[model samples]
Target: MSSALVRNPGDGTNFRYYTNVIEQVVSNAETGGLATVTRSIARPDQAPPLHTHSREDESWIILSGRVRFWVGSTSLDECDVHEAEPGAFVYGPRSVPHTYQAITSTAELLIICNPGAIEGYFHEAGAADTRSDASHSLMEEYGFVIHGNPPPAPQTY
Candidate 1:
C-alpha cells in the first residue's frame, strides 16, 4: 500500500553533477520502483556524454531556457538533432543513444525515468567525494552504456 507524497519546491535531495544542479524530486524507494523524477538546472558546458540506458526509458520536460538533443536509433554518429524550448517535452526510449546540451544560458528540465533506478546513479555520481573514475564505473553499474561525447551545440542558439 502507498500513501500520497508531496514535496514542496526545493524540498528534495539536491546535489551537483559536474556543472549541473540536480534535485531528486521523487525517488524509487518512495514509489516501489515504478519511477523516479529529477529536476536539473544545466548550463551549456554541462552537456552529458552520448549514452543509452539499458534498463529504463527517459523523458524530459523543459522548464526554462532551451536544450538541444541528439537522438539515435543505434549509433551516436547517426542521430537527429532537435532544439527544444521551454514547455517542450522529449522522450528517449530504452537502448536509444541520446544526449542533450543546454543551448541557452541555462536550462531547467524535469527528467522522469521509468522503473526508477537511475536516481541511485545520480545520487552516487553527485556525491561530494565521488571521483571521475568512480563516476564512469557507476554509470556502467547503473546500466548506462556510454557511446561517445555529446554533439556540438547548434550555432543558432
Candidate 2:
C-alpha cells in the first residue's frame, strides 16, 4: 500500500511529486473520494472563465501574489480585493458561478475540494482543449463536458 500522498511522475510530462512542489496537489484518492491541494502560479493575463460545477465545493487559500475571483454576482477587484498572502482562506460552494484572473505575474493558490471533481477532470479527461475527440470521449462517463473558456496557451517552462 502507498503511504505517501505524493505520486512520482518520473520522466513523464506531468509535474513532479512532493519534492518538486505543486500548487495543485492531490493529497488523497480513494474508491469514491479524494482531496486536492493546488499551488498555482498564474500569469497576469491568465484567467479561467465564468463557470459552475455541480459536483464539488471548493476552498481557496492564496499563498502569494494577487488574484481576483468572481462569486455569484459580485466581482472582487484589485482595489477592494481579498489579499491571501500566506494564511488567508476562501470557500466556494458548489453550483456557484464564478471566474478568476491573475492580477500579478506570479500568483500561487491552494484549492481544496471534497469528493474530488476537478482532478478527475484534469487527469482523466486530458483537459478540454488539449485533447482530440478520441482522447476525451472516455471522460463522458464521469460527467465531464466542455462548456466555457478556451484552451490555455502552450508555454515552455
Candidate 3:
C-alpha cells in the first residue's frame, strides 16, 4: 500500500541535464510503478535530439513561455509540428518519434510518463558526473532509440 505524497514548489530532486534543469517531483517507486512526473526548465538550445520511447507514453503540459513540438508515428521527416504556449498540453505515445524546443527565452513544462520507468533514465543521465562514453548504453537500457537532431527551428522573418 502506498501513502499520500505531497511536493511543494522547489521540493524535489533537481539536476542539470545538458542545459536544461530537471526536477523529479514524483518517483515511480512512490506510486508503485504507475507513473512518474517531472518539472523541467529549458532554453531553445536545450532541446533533445529526435528519439522514440519503446516503453512509456509521455505527455507534457506547458507551464510558461512558448515551445514547438514535433510528433510523428513513422519518421521525423514527416511529423506534425505544434507551437504551444502556457496551458497547452501535448502527448507522445510510445514508439512515436518526438522532440520539442523552447521558442522563447525560457520554457517551463511538466512531463509525465506512464508506467514510470523513464524516471530511471532521467535520474541516471542527469547525474553531474555521468559521462558521454556511456550515453548510448544508458539510453538503450532505458528503452530509448536516438534518431538524430531535431528539425531546425522555424525561421522568423
The TM-score of candidate 1 is: 0.87
lDDT of 3: 0.82
Residue-level error in angstroms, candidate 2, position 66: 1.0
Cα lDDT of model 2 by residue, 6-39, tens digit: 5332321344321223434554353246666556
- Candidate 2 stretches with Cα past 4 Å from truth are 1-24, 28-32, 73-86, 127-129, 132-157
For 1-157, candidate 1 gives per-residue lDDT tens digits of 1789988669988877665667888989888999998898877876888989999999999999999888984455688989899999999999999999888888889999998988777766764455454547878888998888766654535
Per-residue lDDT, model 1, residue 67, is 92
> What is the C-alpha lDDT profile of model 3 across 34-109, one tens digit per residue?
8999999867767878899999999999999888888884456777888998999999899999999888888899
> Of the candidates numbered 2 and 3, which has the greater lDDT value?
3
Collision pairs in model 2: 23-38, 23-39, 24-38, 24-39, 25-37
TM-score of each: 0.87, 0.62, 0.87
Supply candidate 2's per-residue lDDT for 92.
74
Q: Local error of candidate 1 at 122, Å? A: 1.5
TM-score for candidate 2, residues paired by index: 0.62
- Candidate number of the best lDDT: 1
lDDT of 3 at 61: 94
Relative to the true structure, candidate 2 has a C-alpha RMSD (angstroms) of 6.9
lDDT of each model, Cα atoms only? 0.83, 0.54, 0.82
